[model samples]
Target: MIRPLLLLAAASLLLGCAQQTLRGTGDLGVVVERATGSVQIIETSHQTRLARIDGLGDLSHASVVFSRDQRYAYVFGRDGGLTKVDLLKQRIDRRVIQGGNSIGGAISQDGALIAVGNYEPGGVKVFDSKTLELVADIPATPLADGSRNSRVVGVIDAPGRRFIYSLFDTDETWLLDFSQGNTPKITRFKNVGKQPYDALLTPDGRYYVAGLFGEDGMAKIDLWHTRRGVERILDGYGRGEQKLPVYKMPHLEGWTVAGNQTFVPAVGQHRVLVMDSQTWKQTDAIDVAGQPIFVMARPDARQIWVNFAHPDNHQVQVIDSETHEIIATLEPGPAVLHMEFTARGDQLWLSVRDGNEVQVWDPYQLKLLKRLPAESPSGIFFSSRAHETGL
Candidate 1:
């Protein structure tokens, strides 16, 4: 809790606040797929190489978005640079240099606005999805002691709602309402759990879950009533306290919601943790490759793919959610980071962060479909099958 003294101090130092939102529609449908350094476009239907856009610069591609019309794709680099590509011509359209490396982002559901996270100052930049212009930039809450600055990590359009949720490094999450001038009032939570990494939502859009890195636990909270109190899961103890250890590195990536269940990887455990969406209890786990980053799931939740950062066995392990068994080991090599599936679920987009290329895989046969290149690729997203983002 904020002590009365600290509260009074914070109240006196309040400088100002800012919020902005836009209306109408947008152009281009963009999803930034990762390659260590190359811009890749995977075909939605077959995960085929639709095209490759490259030579971004010294900074690596971290987050990407395609224009609504599919004419342009914007790629964000780690050090605040943007590369605009022509999806049709498969060339450079334009680029914008913004804040810092993008941890995550949220595109307005209508495709009008785009918000990206900057790591250094933990700034959030709002952009015009069409012209790719900077609309507004909001700096994260500063620390009194002035530690390493905070960054916005993950962001998504709240399912069935107009509010946008953003996670930051400061152990806090903010709910931004687009209905009222796009200004998101920060809701402060004291015991939100340390190192809160990312959040996932249910298909029906009733629940929102945030992953906790410090503990073997995750905060499974109600979307609408999250502030009331959070439901706990796998909350084990460590040392002299109930503080659980997920892993020394944790490296909790994105989350996959399968049917009424949600699956997430414990990077260190090399296993997928199973949980019931309703109860939010970790039910079971199954073996997979080392350092499994993110999971891919279809609407039916029949097929699930778990990708890894294994140097030797860098492949996506396909599993049958029903049997909870690994059916296929789909490898798309040269060392990659996690997987991004196209909207249709036939193909997969894998980021080759070390190779500067994005690898596409066939979800069924464990075969390599094709390869696309980008500059120091990182985030992989499919707009049609868009989720909050594991990036």
Candidate 2:
């Protein structure tokens, strides 16, 4: 029938499309789960199928982060282990098996090192990117619970060689100094906020801001002086007679920094909060759909795209960055969780979680160009700026 013919034609075109795997450029990797254990890697440029890293056993595919050099992608497999994937080889470089649940991690700028977080034990492990060797396991003690119930959630490196920051499931933040080399002088402290979910350090390392969930707010940690780490809280909501509950269940999910400003997606609040990084002051908040989970911005800093977790109709809403206006809405069918754009900001690639496929969209024309199916593609990472060079 025409349906089979149409699929055949689409397949032929995708097979013929060649993706230039340019190393070390602005590219995105969506670390997604197929079923319970498998992880698929999809190239955003030309919608080419690059590789698949598998063999995990009933493990949860939590998060995926690319090295600063864009050479190796570190995949934190919930129950499996930490997987190091070679970008060039399009294969698994090595898999280091660790006991606790694989929460997630972030890579250093040099790409020579990586930190993997274990949710159960509330510990993080630094590893060798090249040899897949385990370097040091900086065990974190949960603040309130003396119990291992606290989880290491978001992990990002500070500017320069100053500190390593990771937000715990609870309200604690761990700051590790790597300039001292192998043994990083660790300074662990509590973020002056409730339910610290994720944190981002400004490009200049002037501020370390964390998104709060238990309370409707965010915490800004002044890291200008490593010795004197200061923090300020920003209220994100107002309590009405109906009690909208301004700071109640404020789940700050995805965030991005542009110049001296910071944009955060308050998932539970269903709004985006803009703040001044230097002064740690609230600027304005743009409203979006309810349950806005995954938020991202284009490389050009022109638009901010947010993805909702609604099962009935999952979509990506494009908001003008400068104007703070809603511009476009893109639907990738059912169960769409995460999204990423090519370097040039021309094509937008999304993970259709329920469909078990990756949806490719043309941002300029606001069109759905193609859908590349990869079983349980929870994570999709690309190789450099191949797409930008093509256009």
- Name model 1 segments beyond 4 Å from true: 1-38, 42-52, 58-61, 89-91, 159-169, 226-229, 237-253, 311-313, 351-360, 367-380, 386-391
At residue 54, candidate 2 shows an lDDT of: 69
lDDT of 1 at 351: 70
Q: In candidate 1, residue 338 scores what lDDT?
A: 48
Question: Candidate 2: which stretches are off by over 4 Å?
Answer: 1-31, 57-61, 142-145, 166-170, 236-238, 241-253, 311-313, 383-391
Task: For candidate 1, write residues 1-391 as lDDT tens digits.
Answer: 5699898777666632212222111211333433335555554544355556666653333656555554555666776776677666667877777765665566665567677777766767777776778866777766557885666655655643233343455666665555455565445454556666666655555555566665556665565775576666667512233322232232343567777776887634667788786677778777777656667685457887776654433566778988898888765555566466655666666776567676766666666777766555556655553333222
Kindly list the per-residue Cα lDDT of model 2 for residues 1-391, writing each as its tens digit.
9999999999877766734334433443544564856666555545666556666544444666666566666677777487777766767778877747866676665566677777767677888778868777877665565655577755766654433545556567777767768687787776557767667665455667776666666666666665666465567453331323333222232466655666776645567777775566778788876556666777677778777655423667888888888998666677666677676778878878778778788776778899787666554555452211100
Q: Candidate 1, overall lDDT?
A: 0.60
Model 1 residue 85 CA deviation in Å: 3.4
**Candidate 1 accuracy as TM-score:** 0.75
After the best TM-score superposition of candidate 2, give how far the Cα of residue 345 lies from its true spot, in angstroms: 1.5
Q: By TM-score, how accurate is candidate 2?
A: 0.81
